[model samples]
Target: MSDSLAEHVHYLGLANRSDLYRSAISDCIAPDDTVADLGCGVGVLGIFCLEVGASHVWGIDSSDAIYLAQETVRKAGLDKHYTCIASSTFRAELAEPVDALICDHIGYFGIDYGIIDMVRDAAKRMLKPGGAIMPDKLVLQIAGVSSDACHEKAAAWSDDIVPKVFHWIDEQARNTKYPHEFAPGELCSAPVELGQITLNADTPEYFSFEAEIEITSSGRFDGLAGWFKSHLGNDVWMTNSPLDPNGIKRSQAFFPIARPFDVQRGDRISVTIRARPEGNFLAWDITPRGGPTQKQSNWATTILAEADRATLDGPLRLNDNAQASQYILSLVDGQRTAAQIEETVMRDRPDLMPSQQGTRNLVRDILKRCAVS
Candidate 1:
């Protein structure tokens, strides 16, 4: 690989925060536990797991970085306990059932690299039933704004590709910098559903999404801001355009931003996002065709707490809100329990126990409604 490409891959190995991952796997580890790091990418996280006393650690990656990870293992003299595999996550075989799975395959907005879905599938095949995943939760957020700095960076693409941003992003791959930008305080922390990434994979090759979004703030919005915030356990997490670490930036975690787009106060900007698999990640396009933009796929709710609601065409019935409605919805996927969800919410909003209770109740109610639907 060229020096820059190698640098980017290597950076991925070191750039991530291992402390968060270490703390996450601590609870799930046993002396003889078998662990698999999906999309291992140079095996830094796996190394940390081994250091913390995991018995057997396997790191899997589709990229060339698997070799680098192997070298790192040998250099660390960990060859006996840690193993590296150079193959696509979907096709890899394991020596035994895994006790836990660690995956940080998340990309900008959580879907670009198909990591989340990969996690779900890998977890299904590799992990023992009830085995935990490192990141228990992930969320995507969105907002409206035209950013000049963002436009300028995306415009720096080579002559081999089109100069405009947000259209056919795959053609702009030469620009190593990830395209797309987020404006200050412009994100709507929307609730998301699982399968956001998997649905795209099932979508026909020529697929797209269009929506109307009203700009809440008047700024030169050259494009939309999309990002994913992930919590590795009950305690550790990271966010693109993070609210805690101002200016730490998400480190190129966005895609398909528009170029030199302009917007005014009360202006409704219509936006569309398109995607297809390219290389190891999903390639996409974002277009502003009209009004306030709709939320991006990653930012929108996928599995609604009320998705199973039974609808009656006969009449509009006013259903009373109950605690069960929310509770059931929260537990629909079997991925999270009521107590776990409560703990997560409490960590983020410590003073809102009542609100959390109400939210959980509503979730159960929604699930009940969906079940009857």
Candidate 2:
């Protein structure tokens, strides 16, 4: 099977994940309620909404998996109650606001994949007053761990090996966060709650939190382990914590330090984590009470890049691509269907769009930028 199909298969097989969402959505939805499933993978959440008596469920996704989702809904005999839209939640518009908006965009650390910004936008424009936002809260926790396996992957670039992992990759590998499953004894320090995110609230562009973690066992402080408990609502929740037997086995986020340092029982380590400016961590500082500190940032890249400041800084002129796009968009004057517009564009602008598939892709991509219902 293809990777995309395999992914959806995996999603469908995640009984732990599906159960929580199913229960939570069932608790909140009524027979007359309309629901929106953003990033509706396999349409399972939307189907759960329908099964629980939601009136009309809209499942929006940007991938071609939308076709698979449509088929899934039809196969379940829920086509009449469901509508699958092949568009990004950022671009997809709903006709008449939904009574609730649900999404499964919570990343490993609970707040990655730009879900916060997307949910913030949806809450404002898509949901009705007091509309439910499932998994409204993400409770973050962190602990120090010792794992040769986890450290080796991040430190591999520094090894004197033949294939030559670039020296620059050392910075990126160590700085970037990873997902790991910690053995019961892997943790050197007792896990502590770091912070949380309420999905619908106005959150800061950058969120930072510091903690003093005390070691409970003797081991090398290889890195920090982070996980979250997502509150899906109505007493239903799921977590990726290593110790939770009932939680989803999705693992936890791990950040490898530059060097492995030794720590003993009762030793305190100071840690400060900065997350956001977009989903992932920007920087993390780990310092042993009386030893050296390891500080890393994802922003520090090896490549020298130029800033983009064209239309933002001054007068704008549309290029051929933008011009063709704008002219095709003009065809969507509230009377023509997307298919009608595509045929018109392919016929009228043979010079601009030579191939049929290319013309269709272009027209549909341009349509992704509009918020038409």
Candidate 3:
């Protein structure tokens, strides 16, 4: 495993936050119930289920951590009761329906990792008619925050650089989403529940939410701070909100405004958030009371320059690159193998395929993308 992934697994394995999950599993699992543990890192939750008297547990994870999960089950002498599948829970199939579905796919804020869609699909496919889902509901919370330190960290690339270079770098950074930690004192407004999703029911992949937050203190509004509250089971829940005294140690989402604005205690901040499950994109528009609206999206941070926007909006046509791709694709007539195609392309278009190794790589990439499975 990569060092980062190993460290992540190790940290999560030892996080005190996991105690909430263990307690919930112990309280919810029945003696004869079968559990499906999605994204089961080290099989900890699955083994906990077995220890709590679950009949069996199916642990699924797409990473190499699944092997460690299997090993953990064996070490616990519960190998006969736990089965680890080294595949994404979305793609894996179960022979029998499970009595409960357990997953810890929630990202830093809440739905950043596409857990909403994953859990919804698992409930439809692998869950029994009346099966329960851990963390049955999720609530997304948002509040206006005044944190010059956090804003400076995000906008660091804009300093001491040429205008064009800084714009490019800033654009790239804004396009990419990141989790940011916020100190309690940074909160400028009371939190508002933006949205909620019940995991046991079918849900749309796209969600739109709008909420108005009342500014509780006077400060500059630099961005919106976001967190999540997950209901694990009866009277068992976990949250990352700084306002929650019992909240876990987790990063919060900070959606920065293009420009900071001052606000008073009575001013209101209106927020509209649109979420796309496929790319985990979050688009937000903030309109402070009597202030101009500012729009930002996680996928594309800033509005493109006029010239760039015009070029992108222009009609599409095949260029020299497209013509070359067409020629290469024409060579795949189902009669010649990929090797033969590469040889012919190398001989005919040496300008595109300069080296034999490069030609092989180009052909392999083309086939991997265009070949019929």
Candidate 4:
């Protein structure tokens, strides 16, 4: 099966995940409500809205999965109530504002997946004033772990296994986040509520917080684990926390340290987590009282995929694509239609333009960034 097909199948097969989403959508959506499923994978959530009597449903996805979503809705005889938008959230334009917004962008660690940015942008541009958002609030939790494998996994830099010239690769591996494979029972410290997230006018571009974890059991402190509790309104809630019985069937993100140390009951550890503006770059510091701190940050260890230093440090200049982009964006004035703008670009900037098909993609790419609302 294709990647998208396999993803949809996995989502559908998740135990109790769909049932909970169906319940949440049904509770908030009314018969006359128009719902938009932002990042709708296979439009499963959009179909749920239709089954619950929504007047119309919009399935918005950045992938070709939207095509399959259209087919799925048609196969269910619910095509009349649904429309597929084959665009990313940045480029998607709705005929009218939606009454509710639902999405699947929330990652295992909640805010790490960028639900804040998606919800904030969607609410400002596409949602009605009083629009209801599924899983409106999220609570982030953190805990200290005691796992043999977690520490062993991070201390992977061996002369036999890897050469000294490529030590940087092992360093990057140590700073990266891994899927939490261990259970909650391995927790050395009680899970503490690090922060909460709700997208609104006042929400920050990314999350930053620090908290203290009090050790509850005597064990080796290997690393830190992160999870989330999501409130879907109407008394419905779900979590990916290993400790929560009703957590969605998903793995949490575990941050491992290079050296594992012993901690006794009542010991304290200071934990700090930070994210870049878009939440793509993550960093954390785990420090034990009176001991050395182990810092794990993708920005610190990884060079290639991290932010561009030149852009941040100096005056930048736009290239040819940017010049073409500027001309295309100027046409996005309040008055001109998309078709009208396309025709104008073809006539005026033939030198900067590509072939018939490439021109369309170029124009669409340039203007979509500014197409809020």
Candidate 5:
């Protein structure tokens, strides 16, 4: 194994294995049962299970930790019953279904190793119907707040320059890769670091989860960190935070301001995260420090025509209210031309008229995108 995998395996050395031990003891494994250890790391948890009387253990990992696990198995004189494979959970290549599956290869936000999805798929293909899984589910939670410091930090890091020098530089670097991953959208304004994440779990089911969070910063909130919860079974819950409690630190997905607005302190920023067959999405809000007076997307109402939507594709993150999306939607009847739709929409929604020419131009752009091949 190379040094990189070795280092990755060594990370298990830092894990607080007390949770694994407790879960193993409480779950009640038989003397001759089989276990498949996913993301086995140095195989400490699997080795620990053998110490506690498990009959057979198979350890799998993507890192160099498999070598360490094999060494540990050999030293313990359990070579017959304990084995190690240096591979990912998605391709463990094991021949037999096991009685239990053990995995702790999760990051702060929980899906970093792609192990959760792997395990979910594995349970469907590899495990027997009566088998148990340890550390099953994880959950995420969030709160909102206002802060000058957070705003300043975003401004400092954002690409909002007045004279346009930085914008040109940004354009040059559009195709270049960064040391870290950047979001799909351009940075319209500054952003704030929402919070950190922590891990907590161990139970039945392939996976199971919950999160409790305290929000510190608040603003006219635009986006948020993705938090998640997994349920191992009805019994165990795990939490994944963008504000990671472990040393693993990386950026969270950016949540753009659905509508531009002002936010204040003490506002409750509440969010819930769940999984779907497709992918993950989040809905969030910040209560005005005051009462409900104006909706957040009022700027959109002014700029968007009934037949238009914004071109949110690039740095500007334009709104669809501009007659883009709706115009295309309207064109489906094939009876009305783009110009006709613009005229009708203008008549119905006068608020969209910054000017007549602008409306015509917006409609023209939409029709251009909707032009059939």
Candidate 6:
């Protein structure tokens, strides 16, 4: 198995998240029912369903780790009730309709990692009529946060310790999105519901929402914090909200501002969010009431400056290897094997790739990038 997949399997083997999912699965599943476990890493969820008296479980994942999941089921003596498929739910064909579908595709703040599209597609195609999905409803909440700790971590690069390197790091921090942990006392305003997402056949692939939050405490506002609450069946649910006593332990979404602003009680902050299910891109705009608004988008951050563009558009300089990289990428057709590609690269550009071993490593790296499965 690949290192990345192994890391994921190790993470899923941890007790905290697995315990929560096991409890929810036991509550939602029924005897003599077929279950579809989407993105089933190591087949834990499907095995949990089988232990709860599920008739059969289909464990599907896109990674090669499905082989490990099959082995896990066999070792547990549950292979007769579980089938592991090493294919994405988008391309895999189900032999029979499932009575319920369960997936933990949620990311930080509950929108990233393309969960919405995956759940929507499975609900429409793989589930039987009236079939239920775990965490059927999701509500995203946003609040204005006053966190000196977070501000220090995000703006540390602005210090004059290392001028050139820190300046670039400061720019990157301002232009990037991050997952953060917020102390309850750091919240300057009560969380407001930003949006609600329902997983079903009628849900749209694109959505936009706006909300106004009233600040209840006086403090410095550096950015916004986002978390989600999910409604699993039988009144079992999980949330990461700061106010919830029984919420899951997970990071909240943090969108850093270019600069911090001081504010007083009764101040109002307006926020707008746009989400695209296709690429799981979320754009946010936050404005202090009567102040200038700032916009940040996960889809279009790190823009190139005009000066940099002009430099690239100028005459080709010596020792520039961008063309060689492009040529290597161009040869990544579906028909050519990695060995053939390595031989062609060695024969064509011996100066770029000197040794056979180096060419083989280069070909392997390029093929990994170009691989779709």
Which number leads on TM-score? 2
Q: Report the candidate with higher lDDT, 1 versus 2.
A: 2
Give per-residue CA lDDT, model 1, range 110-172, as digits (tens): 556665567766776788877767765655554553545555555544334555454444334
Which residue pairs collide in model 4, if any? none
* Candidate 2 lDDT by residue in tens digits, 1-373: 2766887887667648888888888788878799988888678888888888899999998876788889988988889989999888988898889998888877777876667877888888899988888878888888998888888877877777825646767877787777788886888889999888898788888889898899999978898998889899879988988888887777678888887888899999999988882575457899999888889777654344343423467776877888987898788888887778878887888566667787778888887666264
Question: What is the C-alpha lDDT profile of model 4 across 15-42, one tens digit per residue?
Answer: 6688789888878889989988999988
Query: What TM-score would each prediction reach against the true structure?
Result: 0.58, 0.83, 0.79, 0.81, 0.50, 0.80
> How accurate locally, in lDDT, is each candidate?
0.57, 0.82, 0.81, 0.81, 0.50, 0.80
Q: Candidate 2 versus the native: TM-score? A: 0.83
In candidate 4, position 188 carries an lDDT of 86
- Where's the lowest-lDDT run of ten residues in candidate 6? 316-325
Candidate 2 vs candidate 4, lDDT winner:
2
On residues 1-373, what C-alpha lDDT tens digit does candidate 6 reach at each position?
7874766655575435777777888888999899999888777778889989999999999876678899888998888999998788897779889999998777767777677888888888899999979868878899998898778766877866758654766756765667787888888898999999887647676888899999989989988888888777776777877677666667788877877899899999899888887545778788998999988776555466774456566676544356666777777788877677778888887566667677667667766755543
lDDT of 5 by residue, 59-122 (tens): 8876666777788789979888898876667766778888877666554344444545656766
Runs of candidate 2 exceeding 4 Å displacement: 162-165, 277-281, 301-373
- lDDT at position 345, candidate 5: 65
**lDDT of candidate 2 at residue 37, scale 0 to 100:** 89
267-360: candidate 3 lDDT, tens digit per residue:
9888998987643688889998888898888667555666456565667777666776788899988898887888898887866656767767
Q: Pick the candidate with the highest lDDT.
A: 2
lDDT accuracy of residue 174 in candidate 6: 63
lDDT of 6 at 253: 80
